[model samples]
Structure formats: C-alpha cells, structure tokens
Target: MSNFKRASLIFLLAFLALPLAGFGCKQGDLEALRQLKEPVVLQWWGVFDDTDSLKDIIASYRALHPNVAIEYRKLRFEEYEQALLKGWAEGKGPDILFIHNTWVGAYEPRLTPLPPALTLPQLIDPQKGVEKSAAEFRETRTLTAQDIKNNFVPPVRDDVVRNNAVYGLPLSVDTVVLFYNRQLLDQAKLTSPPATWSEVKDAVKALTIQNTDGALLQSGINLGGSANNNRAPDLLSLLMLQTGTTMVNPEGRATFNERLSLDGQAFSPGADALRFYTDFARPTKEVYTWNADLPEAQELFAAGRLGLFLGYAYQLPYLRAQGPKVDIGVAPVPHLNTDATDAGRKQVNFANYWIAAVAKQAENPAVAWDFVLFATRPEQATAYLDRVKRPPALRSLIPRYQNDPDLAPFTAQLFTAQTWYRGKQPAGMDAAFRAMIDAAVDGTRTPEDAVGFGAEQVNQTL
Candidate 1:
C-alpha cells in the first residue's frame, strides 16, 4: 500500500474516543444530521498531516452534517504536487487540498473561491432513510474577507485574499525561530539566546573554534551558505526583508536585486543583505564560522556540535529525536534594529505554512467549503493544535499560548510576520535566490551582480 493508503487503526480509535461535545454537539445539530438525506463525501488531500490529526474534527463535523463523509489521505511531500497536478489534469481530484501560502498565486486558477453562503437540502442524509425534499432548503453563511481579517493574524489576510476574493484558510501559522543548544550557551557563559543580530555576531566569534590549518573544529552558527543548508533561502529572504528591501514592487516585478531610495539616497538593501549573509563563509571575515565545506546545518546542531541553528516549529521533532540528550532552547529570531523605544521601529519575520483551499474541480464545492469552515473554528482548531503541539493562526488563540514556553516564541512573532509575493511561479523565484546565494559564496560574482542577475532571472518567471 502507498503511504497515503495506510491508516493506523490505533490512531483512529484514540481520536474517536475524544469527546465531541464542545467540537460539534450543539442543540440543533442532531436535528440537522438526522433530517438531512444527501450522501456526500469530501476527499481531503494533505501533505504533512495524517488522518490522526483530523479524525476528531471529521467525526465532529459528521455529527453535525451526517450526510457528509470525509476521507483524508496524506501523501509524501515529494509526490504530493505531481499527484495533485496529475489528478486535476485527468478531470478528477480531491475536493479539498492543503497548499503552501506561497503557492496561492500560482495555483489560484485551479481553486474555487469560498462562496458567500451554502444552500443545502433540509432532508439529505441517506443514512436517515429519507429522499431529498422539494422546496425545503437551509442557508449557511461562510466566512467573508472582512471576517478573515478580524479572525486571523495580519499575514493570513494578506496571503489568502487576492482580487477581493478569499481563496484559502489556514488552521495554523508558523514562523522561523532561532534554535540553539543550551549546554553550549552555558559553557560560553551566555545567559540567554541572542536577541539582536549584533549579539549574534559576538556570540559567533566566541563559540567558533578553529584548528591549526584553519579547519572548523566546532562551528558557531549556520549562515552564509546555500545548497547544504535546506533553509538557506528562507534565512536569506528574511534577512533581506529585515533590511527593508522591497522584494517585489507594486507592478509585481522582482526588485530585490535593484537599488531603492532610502532617506533621499540610493541604496541596495538586498545586496547589503546578501553581503552580510555570505560573510560568515569568507575565511578572512571576523565573523567567519560557516562554510560550504561544512555538513548540513541541522545535522550539526542535532549532533550538539553547533551552538546555534535557525529553524521552524516543524523541524523541532527531528532535532529532539536525533539529539535526545541535546538541550534544545528556542528563542525569537534576532532583529536588525534593537531600539524598542523608536515609534517607527517594527520587527519583521518570515511566514511558511499551508492553507486549506477548495479545488475548482470539486463536485460539491459549497459542502466542501462548509466542512473547511467548521474544521477551523476555535474549538476544533484548538484541539488539533493541542494534539500536535503547534502554534495558532487565529488572534483569539494567541493569548491561550502566551504562557506556553515551547509555542510562545513562535506565537509572539506571528502578528508582525510577512510574506512576499512570488508572482505566479514561486519555484522559479526560489531557484533564482539559490543561484544568487551560490554565486556570491563561490566568488563567481559580486553581491550586487549576483542579486541583479537573480532579479533578471526571476523577472522571466513573472
């Protein structure tokens, strides 16, 4: 059986045991489920999560809409895109899908916008042994664009709404955070993780240990290189954003590589960020620590040899499992400007998460969307988050995690998080970034030239 085909019976039973009172058992729920006679099945395709994470929500939703049956399938990330594309091309695909926030533009044409309201039959549940009744229907209001802004954080509204149409909804939002080894920090006599990039530079100088032939005996942090570092693109992109680089202009062209006006002077914020990122790989730089010769960053950190590593909430599981004895400490990613007193000061972070969207090919788009709406409610969403130990996407749930040590760091950064438009070709844009970083690190091109070339390449995709 394929990875998507296999479902663990144990996981299903555990979730089935969870109480559905708060999730769905409202006063009129039984009447609706019993009266409906339509038999509808919604196929939900996801990449990261399995049925275990959603089984309870599915059960709860069924309790309210007995006519609707949900079948969830989880595919390997590598195979997910091809499968979705192939299915759509064949005129068959899942009614519901999980897409990355960046994929919204590229995949917009293939999605159906959430409807203003869903009109359903009063007696549609085939299990209730009743036929569809004529002229008796009920209307359900779906979320409006304004409701999205009022509910989720700022970035959620920015990503899901385009052309005044809401295309997707997210169960949770995740941000990049700094992951470090606590034992290494204690040995260095540093009391806490670095709060500012300036502190990061100082800590790197102190933690890095070099051998006689200038080989790295122990590395300080993971920065300044690509290809080997899986998250190098995100790191570089976040740095450019923090430096006030406008990644894409109002005309929707790739301008990160070009110079922009800053305080009545022409400056290249993207090039500056590139130079700063590649410096750590240069042997002559005072803050040198990382190099292309080093192993993959997370691996080094997992083995407890690297002092600091930049990562996301999803990467925590592997780190903990691999380095069971490693004391892992997470902190908010460092900021460019440390002045909290400045009224104009703003802290920027990067966003990377998935959004639930309805495919244009869905046979029952309205019913499919209604399930999506019910599953994202606070009560249902909180259960999923609590089970998975992840952060929240809704503003109302932020305070619930304020005192949580593991999730607080990520939750604190969601409000000001930002994501840039990747035009209609996010993959092409991503490739350009990797090539630019490589050219600068390998000395094949100056930071300015590399960024300019990258912008030119990205423009072709736009």
Candidate 2:
C-alpha cells in the first residue's frame, strides 16, 4: 500500500478504538495499544537557514514525545521550490515544510489544514520510585482564525488565513527599516534621522556632495532604479501603502492606479508615490542624489558613503561584519507625518518572513502539525528567536523583545506592518514594479500611465 493508504488505515483503526473504548471496553486495553504503537519520524525541509539552528528545539519536542523524531534539511533558495514540487509529485515530499509568505497562494492546494487538536499518550508521573506506565490524554487545543488574529501581528492574519481556515503559523517576522550611518549624520550636523519624507528631502540636500565633474561623491539615500537598487519593490510598495494605494482589489485585480477624490480633491496615490520614489534619481529634482550608475545600495551603505539604506533584520550581522568601522543605526521607516490631527494617515511597513506549514503529502499530518504548534509556543519560540535574532511574530513576546538593540525598530512597527497578495506569479509582479519605475524614469510614460501600465501587467499574472 502507498504511504497515504497505510496512514489512512492507521488513523481509521485508531478512531475505531475510540468507539470501542466508549462502549465499555477496558480503557487499559486502549492504553496498551497506544504504548505499543510504532514510532513516527517526520522529514522537514527548510531554506535560508541550517538544521543546527533548530536542533535544540527539535530535541525539546522529542522530550515530550520520545517516539517522534524530526529530520531537517535546508535547501538553497534558487533551487528550493522546484525541488519541493518535484518531490511532492513523486510522493516523496517532506512531512513539514517552510514556505515564503508570498508563496502561500500558490501552494495552498498542496497544503493541509492544521488539525484542530490531537490526543497523545504521555507520561504524567515520574517519582513513583517504580516505572510508571504512560496514559492516553486528551488535548483539546486548536488555534482558531480569531486566535491567530489576536495572537500575532496584523499582516500574519492576511498571509496565513484562507477561506476562514488557518493554513500556517510564523515564528518570526521581519520588516524593512531605515539603515543609516551614524557618522554621516554627525558630519551633516543632524542630531537624528529624518522622520518624514520632507525632512528626508532636506537632509539629502544637505548631505549629498558633488564632485567637480558633477558626479556624486557621497550619496544621501538609495532610491529609484530597479536593477541595482536593493529591495526596490519593497520600498515602492511601502510608499504606495503609506499613500493609501490599495495594490490589489477585492476581485484580486491590480488596481493601484485607480484615482481617488478626497473632499473634492482628485489625485492618484500610486502615481504620486511613484513620482516621490523616482524623483531621487532625477537630476532636475532637489532630492536628486542616486542614479543608475551608482553602486549597489547595500555595498554603498557598507562602504559608509551612503546616508540611508532600507533593509531588514536579517542583514544586521552581515552589515556589521562587512563594515566593522562603520557606525550604523536603525530607525523605523519614515511616515508622511506623525501629527495626530491627520489621523486618517496610517503608518505602514513591509513584512517579509517564512511560515511553517504541513504538506498535503505528509503521511502523518496530525503529528506534524502537533510539532508545529509546539515549536511556536511561547517557551519554544523564544529559543528560535534568540537563535535567529528576527522580530517575534507572537504578540505576547513583542513587549519582551521591544527593547532589543537590533530588534527594537522592527518590533516597533509590527502592528503597522502590512503585505499585499502578488498572485501566483510573485516574481513577475515584482518585475512589473521594476518595469513601471523604468518607464517613468525614461519619460516614456507619465507617472500615472506608468502605474496604470504596471497594474495592468500585474493583473495578467493574477
């Protein structure tokens, strides 16, 4: 029999015991059968990080269920998805898997909903001086859609929930923040980083220096140009969100180009946001500093010549290692304004992280989900966060890590962090964003037309 058939039969027989035990059969008989049940081992595939990072957490799960073992394998990012799809097609996929938040829509068909709850046989007493037998215990526990919304950051709900079903859980979440050079700010006589786009414009003017040939000697910020710019799509998306541009509409169509009227004022937020972003690369604009000829943003930031670069927590260690002499500091991404009078203005950030999911091909879906829930629990999640050093996804743990030096900025923005569904072709959607920027910069299309064209292209992917 296939693994699925065998697993189905096993679960069916286990349920059959429930009715028998309910009909006056001795409970000890069921307990004995549970104790004699064969052990279950699960294969887990991951990306970006190694297995050693999770070895200790896996060991902790094994302590509770001595019969369960988890084998973890980390794959290269360039090859992960293709390998996973091929493996699943051959019926040899891992039991538990890690997938990108943006890829959830594409993988929904191959994923299994988390079991509501599960019962397991465990040892309760230990100090009896004699060996004690384990007993079957009922665990009436499940994470509901509401529980997910209440327990995690806001974007998590939109990313993991589908058709009112909880599909996955995230251990950590990352948000883009302003990575600035402390020394550069001091040189410009600025006491602190800019908190608004206008202030950033003024600061860039004061900080950007020019050479005799009109070439940039030191740039104020990294923005515009998609090929060499690091995370250009994320930065542009952040601006669109801050300007209240709904990238995707209720019908799953890309409608970011739609114009709006506010109090008799008409404007296209997406177009305005695109103009605000591309102006930095325009020589005619006051905020002009960077251009297509500049080095990569990350490299420029590490070289201590760039004033600001937008990045996530995952790059902290790398930035520090790459530039030991550079004095760097992190701050929340700038907002339009911090004034309370304009309460309609919302503060939004970009969210990027992986989620833990149960594969449909798993022979032991219930057991795999049990381990997932355990790993995300407060006690266990702390270990994973400490090792990974990413922002905590759980709401309760946010306060504890809010003061962390590397995590503070990201945690501060967790409540406001948001993401958009990029359809099944997320890469293509990102490419469309780049193409839109290119069209605007080349003057081939106005900002309004550029955004409309981009949305139309993305709609095709949807």
Candidate 3:
C-alpha cells in the first residue's frame, strides 16, 4: 500500500484496538505500539523570517506527539509560487502549506477541505465571540461554524471562505502605513504630517529640494519601491479602493476597464494611478526620485534622504535595526479627501494575510489540522504577533495595538483595509497590469489606452 493508505490503516487499527485494550490488553501492549521504532515524518512548507521561532514551534509540537516527526522547509516569498505549482503537479509537495490570502481562491480546489468535524461553529460560538479579557482572536479547536462566526473578522474571513466553507486559518495580518522622517517635516516648516492626499502633495512639493545643476539634493517621497515588485501596482490598488471602484465585480471578475469610467469618458484608474505615481519622478513634480541602481526605497527613507514612504508595520523592526538614529513617525496612508462624510471610508489601504492550509495529499490530515489549530490559537497567535511586532488579525487585539504610539494609525486603518485579488490568473493579471503601467509611464500609451489594454489582457486571461 501507499504511504497514505498505510497511515490511514494505522489510524483505523488504533481506533479499532481502543476497546480491545480496555477489555484485556496490558500497558506494555500500548507502550510497544506507541514506541514503535518507525519514522513518521510529515513535510511542512512556509515563508517565515525567523527559523528559530518555527523550530521552537515544531519542537513544542513534537513534545506533545512524540510518535510523529516533521521535516520543515522555508521558501522565500519570490520563489514559493513557482515551487508550489511544480510540486503540486508532481504530487510531491509538503503535507501542510502556507498560502497568501489572495492565492486561496486559486488554490482551493487543490487543497483538502478541512474536515467538517473541524468546523469553526462546532469549535466556538459566533455570537459569544472568543472569551478573553480583551476579546483576543483565538484559533478554534475545530473547524466548526461557531469558529467561523466568532474568531475571524469579516472581509478577511471572506477571503478564506469559499462556497460557505473555511479552508485555512489566518496567520499574520499586515496593512500599509505612512513612514515619514520627522527631520524632513521639520526642515520644511511643517507642523504635522498631512491628513489628506492634497495636503500630502503640498507637503511633498515643499520638502523636495534640488541644486541648480538639477541633481536632486533630497526627495520628498520615495514613490517607487522595489518591494512588492515596485509600488506602482500597490499604489494603484490603493487608489482604486479610494475611488470606490471595486477592481473585481461581485461575480469575482475583472472590472477595471468595464465599471470604472469617469464622467462618461473611459477612465483607466489603473493607468491614472500609475501616472500619478510616476509623476513624482518628473523634475517639476514634488520629487524626482528614481535611479536604475540605488538602494531600496525603504533604505533611502531610513537613511533620511526620502521624507516619506509607504510601508507595513513589519518594516519598523528593520528601520530600528538599520537606522535607529533617524526620527521616524507612523501615520495612516493619507486619504484622498478628509471630511466628516468620509469618516467611515476616508483613506484606502491594503491589508494582507498569511494563511495555512492542508495539502490534499497530506498523509495525516488530522494531525496537520491539530497542529494548525494549536499554532494559531489566541495565545500562540498573540505570541507570534508580539515577536514580529505586527498587528493581529483578531478584532480584540486592535485596541491593545491601537494604544501603541507607533502602531495606532496602522491598526485604525484596518477597518478600511482593501485587498487585491487576481482571480484564477494572478500572474497573468499582474503582468498585464504592470505592462499597462509601464506603457503609460513611458508615454507610449495614454491612461485610457493603457487601461483599455489592461482590461483586454485580463479578460483574455479570464
């Protein structure tokens, strides 16, 4: 029999022998089975920065179940997608896996549907919420309906739930925040960071400085970051969210070119957002800040050369490590417009989540699920968040982090956090979007043309 069949048989035999042991079996009989000198190694693949933390988790798990062993592998973010696809095709992949929130939709069919016994509702009550002093989000013991109702925040919950079923547990949450150099604002005579996009634009213009030779002395904002494969797409996604244009329709289809038209003219929000982004590099714009060969945008911001950058909460650790001397302040990504009416929906921010799922070919689904539950439980979740200094996905942890001076603004924006998804063709959609942006930036295509082309490419892929 195959490995899977053998594992299934072992579990079945264990269950069948339970009553027999109670009737007549001795302690040594059970001990002999438990101590069976056979290796039962499970494979796990994930993206994690700290290997020691993962090892600690694995060690803790192994302590609880001494019979089972795990071989853990870490894949870099950039390499994970292709690696996973190749592994899946060969039916030789990790038994458990970590997938990005946006990837769930594409990979759902490939993953095992968490057993009904593990349903969230059976695990926790939705109305009651998790019972904790601060209403901390905790992982449910089972994937029951109650677990779904109580633990997960909406929209985020929506991402992992397909066809009214939960497939994975959220691991870490991230949202975009503004990182500004205090000295730069002070040098420009600014009293505080901008609250609205218009204010931000004005501030950028004021802070940007150049010598007579036209070489930039300092830039107000580092508009193009290599992280996230350059910030143009992320910036556009944020803009689309702000403009109240859902890039995908309710049917989960691309709507960029179809639904978003400004004043009867076909407006490519994607192109417009890109143009606005690259405009910062123009000599007359607020900042001329792009070089083929330069340190990363975050590094420039940390080095005090750039006044502002869009970064996630995780970047704080790196900033502290790389440039402790720079006076840095965090704020919400500036709103398109700040008004009382916009209170509930002012700025558009992007939120990202990491999800853990069981592979369809997993030899021990029950065991994998149990470990996932233990790792994502409230106490453990909080511990991971504390280690990474990232915001938690649980609703209750929001207030605790909100009180944090550095983390408050970011946590506050979680309510308005919008996510991006490329449906079944993420790579294709991303490529098309990037091509359109490049065309618009290079002046080869107008914003309208770029958006139209992007829509066509996306539609073709769909």
Q: Name the top TM-score candidate.
A: 2
Q: Which stretches in model 2 have alpha-carbon errors above 4 Å? A: 1-37, 119-132, 137-139, 340-343
C-alpha lDDT score of every prediction, in listed order? 0.86, 0.86, 0.69
Error of 2 at 451 (Å): 0.9
Give stretches of model 3 more than 4 Å off.
1-40, 86-92, 118-141, 144-146, 224-229, 259-272, 284-294, 339-347
Q: What residue pairs are clashing in model 2?
A: none
Off by over 4 Å in 1: 1-35, 122-135, 261-265, 340-344
Error of 1 at 89 (Å): 2.2
Going through the candidates in the order shown, the clash numbers are 8, 0, 14
lDDT of 2 by residue, 1-462 (tens): 999999999999999999877755547635634653557889999997688778878999977677788999999988999999999988888999999888888888899987667765555452331135444455757898889999999999999998888788988999999889999999999889988887789889878988998798889988867888968988899889888888888989998999999999999999999999999888888888988888888888888888988899988888888988899999988888854111156677889999999999999887889889988998888998999888999999999899999899999989989999988788888899999998887789999999999999999888
TM-score of 1: 0.87
Q: Write down the TM-score for model 2.
A: 0.89
* lDDT digits (tens) for residues 248-323 of candidate 3: 6676667765434566876555555656666665555544554334467777777787787777887788887788
